[model samples]
Target: MATKVTEMNEVKSSGIPGLDTLLSGGFSQGRVILVLGEPGTGKTIFISQFLYGGTTQGNENSMFIGMNEPKSRFMIEMSGVGMDFDALERNGKFSYVDATEVRRIPEQAKVGRIHVGGRELGLVNLIDMMQEGMAKVTPKRIAVDSISDLVFRFPTIEERRPVILDIIESLQTTGATCLLTSEVLSTGEERTVQPEEYLAEGVILLRRLPRKGMRSVQVLKMRGQKVDTTPRPYTITDKGIEVYASEEIY
Candidate 1:
């Protein structure tokens, strides 16, 4: 983590207490935040908490666009951790768009069936499908469970950059604070930076130290909010990722 400062007036609680403190009181309003980490570093759990907190505590509607997993399986797993998406969706406060499934079963994942603008959308153009879903939900908060798949989807930066920018731009238009997730491996003092880190307004990097058997969270960059660069230790329990903002870990 590096120290870089900025100022902001209004913020949204991230639902993780220590993290909110590191973020100077949570994500800036409508800011695009990237949660970067390797597999099992709790990226999905972190975003799940953000959306769950928004619907349950903030009373705001939110959307989860999942690329790497099935919606049914994802929800059931999250339910084990205490986030009841089915209950929230039943009340019309939460909506989900399975990004990968649309690519797999375009006929089965019908736009009208999902109520995404009540029209047809082709798999080749995912942004259109995302747009229709956003417009239909008009959520106050939006999350893409792990757009890290895009890093592989496009393969090369040239092929990936446009698509990445396009999705971020589209999300910006929805006027919802967005949380994006990606996968990255961390070494001793250096880590690989994904393309999404460059495009996002803020980047929250999570890492697991194998020798210590502990996970840590850091604010790599926050465009409009003051950032506390200290590496904060965090853990994934039954509730979700609980960040200890000011604590140090071995």
Candidate 2:
């Protein structure tokens, strides 16, 4: 949930204490935020917290469109962190759209738990499905688990670029604050810039700390907000991703 922004810079709380402080409030209202990290850096946990917090605490409607994971597995994983997506859905505050099996499933067919229908499940079809889902739930906060699956579905960069841009553009039109997760190809000091990093209005990067299993989070950029770009230590606690904004990474 977010406060009504009377001014252009007014923000909403990310619901994560240290993260909100690092964001200087929270993410800009209705803007697309890119959460970038390597596989185990808790990007999913971050977005899950955002949506779950909004629906459960802020009285907001939320949706999750997952492209790489099944709804069952996703729910089980989130349950470990104390999020009951099933309950939220039962209460009409949450919705999940699973697109993991789009490539293999035939049109208008049910593959296990996912239902794929109407067209061949390409980029265009996925966007259409998203729009349909939006019309039903009309969420205020939305998350696309990882746009990387859709990004890499095509063979070339020329083809991939427009697909991603189109998806982002479509999300922007929904009037919902959106969080799109993306995987970092390289985890070391040097990393290539991905298109989503520059395209989204805000970017949050997570990195694995060199000291064993810890993690670090940084706000790379936020278009209309004064952001703290400092790298802060964070950890995946039982509740969820917790950031130590004022603490040094050592």
- Give the number of the best model, judged by TM-score: 2
Worst 10 residues of 1 by lDDT: 115-124
18-116 per-residue lDDT for model 2 (tens digits): 898888888776899999999888888899999998888888899998887888999999999888999999988888988775544444664478875
Segments in model 2 whose C-alpha atoms lie over 4 Å from true places: 1-9, 103-121
Deviation of model 1 at 223, angstroms? 0.4
TM-score of each: 0.84, 0.88
- Candidate 1 regions with alpha-carbon error over 4 angstroms: 1-9, 102-124, 185-188
Q: Whole-model lDDT, candidate 1?
A: 0.76
The deviation in Å at residue 109 for candidate 1 is 16
Q: Across residues 1-250, which tens digit of lDDT does each residue of candidate 1 receive? A: 9755443335889877567889878887677788887788888878888989988999988888888787898898899778999998899888888787544432334445463321123224566657766776678888887765545555577766776787788788777888988777454575566677799898888888775768888888999568898777887888777888778877
Q: What total of clashing residue pairs does each candidate reach?
A: 0, 1
Error of 2 at 56 (Å): 1.3
